[model samples]
Target: MPTLLETYIENRFRVQPNHANNNETLHGGTLMKWLDEVGAMSAMRFAGETCVTARVNELDFKRPIGIGDTAVVESYVYDAGRTSVHVALRAWREEPRTGEREETTASSFTFVAVDSEGKPTPVPELEVGGAEGERLRDRALSRDR
Candidate 1:
């Protein structure tokens, strides 16, 4: 079994002109792509198998990230079933120099592990035991409410 913390993944992307809209903020599609990529990585880490996104819950964009800012994406597996891994994802607008960050986007995703034949494959049980693991799981769960 893999612990919940073992499935955590974080990645940062520097918003450039190509990733921004006419208003000079990160484009929604670009952010969504980054979120999906990070979420899939976390699911794969937990499942130990190729995972495909099954569903994406509501994505709420709280603020815009400027072109020169950095988008920090974090993801972790909070819960899992026989074949499905549930991941919580969050993105923050960060100032590289000041190291300041503010939440910009939040969402959850469901991914299913797959075999070579593209059929569903079973995933190992997630160990959310320890205080750190439990705290992480609780925080993710609470965000849904």
Candidate 2:
């Protein structure tokens, strides 16, 4: 059994000129790619197997990460089924120098653990407890519902 905290993942992506759009903000498509990458990694940590993206729920880009800003991405598994894991993901734009942060996007993702033959495989049940685990579980579940 793996705790939710054990599956948590966070990554920072520096917004560069190439990653930005004509408006000088991070491109939405690029951000989605990053989100999927992090989400899959989180699911794999919890599943202990290769995981593939099944679904990415509604994506809402609330704010733009300007060029030179850092995009902080967070992902964690909140619930799991026999072969599927539900992950909660969000991204925030932060000033690299001052560390000021503001949420930019949020969404729920579902991942399915797969075998070498590309077929779905069973995943371990999430064992959640402790203050941190409980808090994340509650937050993810509420957003998921």
Candidate 3:
């Protein structure tokens, strides 16, 4: 069983010349690609099998990550079903010089586990073993609001 912290994965991608848009901010499509990749990895870690995007609940780009900044993405499993896992994901912009970071986007995505044959398979029950875990699960559930 992977703990909440163990399920967490953090990665950073430097925005380069080609990673930007005409306006010099990270492109929406590029960000979505990163989100999908990280979200699937988090779900696969929790499910112990390969996973694919089942759905994207919501994606809110509140701000922009500039071209020269590093895009720091983090993901973790917050909810699960018999074959699906809900991952909470966030991306932040980090200024290399000042070491400042701000969240630029957030999203919740669902992934379904698949077997070696690429068929949907059952996933382990998401374990919320204590108060913190319960709180995270509750937070995930409250996203419906």
Candidate 4:
């Protein structure tokens, strides 16, 4: 059985000219696209098959990442259904030199495992047996203070 922690993913994107808006900050659409890509990867790891995004439960853009900064996207599985996985994903804006960061986006996405024919398929039960897994799941389910 795979644990939620094992499905975690973290990736960073440079806020370059191609990824930024005229204001020199990361564009909202660009951030959303990156979020979906990373979220799907996390869900697929848990499902062990190709996964298709079914829904984005929540997405809040709390801040902005300036040009030359790094956008760190993190994701992990928090729960699972018969054919779907629930994932928590967030983006943080970091100063590449100083390593400072602040939350820029937060989201919950649902992905369904699919067969070659693109039909939903059963996925293995999600396990949260370890302390890390429990902690992560709890944090995802709780409201930030």
Better of 1 and 3 by lDDT: 1
Tell me how candidate 3 scores on lDDT: 0.87
Query: Clashes in each model (backbone N, CA, C under 3 Å)?
Result: 0, 0, 0, 0
Error of 1 at 23 (Å): 1.1
Better of 1 and 3 by TM-score: 1
For model 1, what is the error of residue 84's alpha carbon versus the real structure, in angstroms, after optimal superposition?
0.3
Ranking under lDDT, best-scoring first?
1, 2, 4, 3
Structure candidate 4, residue pairs in collision: none
The digit string of per-residue lDDT tens for model 1 on 1-145 reads 9999999899999999999999999999999999999999999989999999999877999999999999999999999999999999999999999989999999998999999999999999999978988988998888878
Model 1 has a clash total of 0
Off by over 4 Å in 2: none
Please give the CA lDDT of all the candidate structures: 0.94, 0.94, 0.87, 0.90
What would the per-residue lDDT of candidate 4 be over residues 43-131, giving only the tens digit for each residue? 88888899998998888989889989999999999988999998999999999999999988888988999999999999998888789
Tens-digit per-residue lDDT, 1-145, candidate 3: 6766557789999999799999999999999999999888889889999999989899999899998999999888987788888898889999988879998998899999999999999988777667876776677667646
Q: Which stretch of 10 consecutive residues in model 1 shows the poorest summed lDDT?
A: 136-145
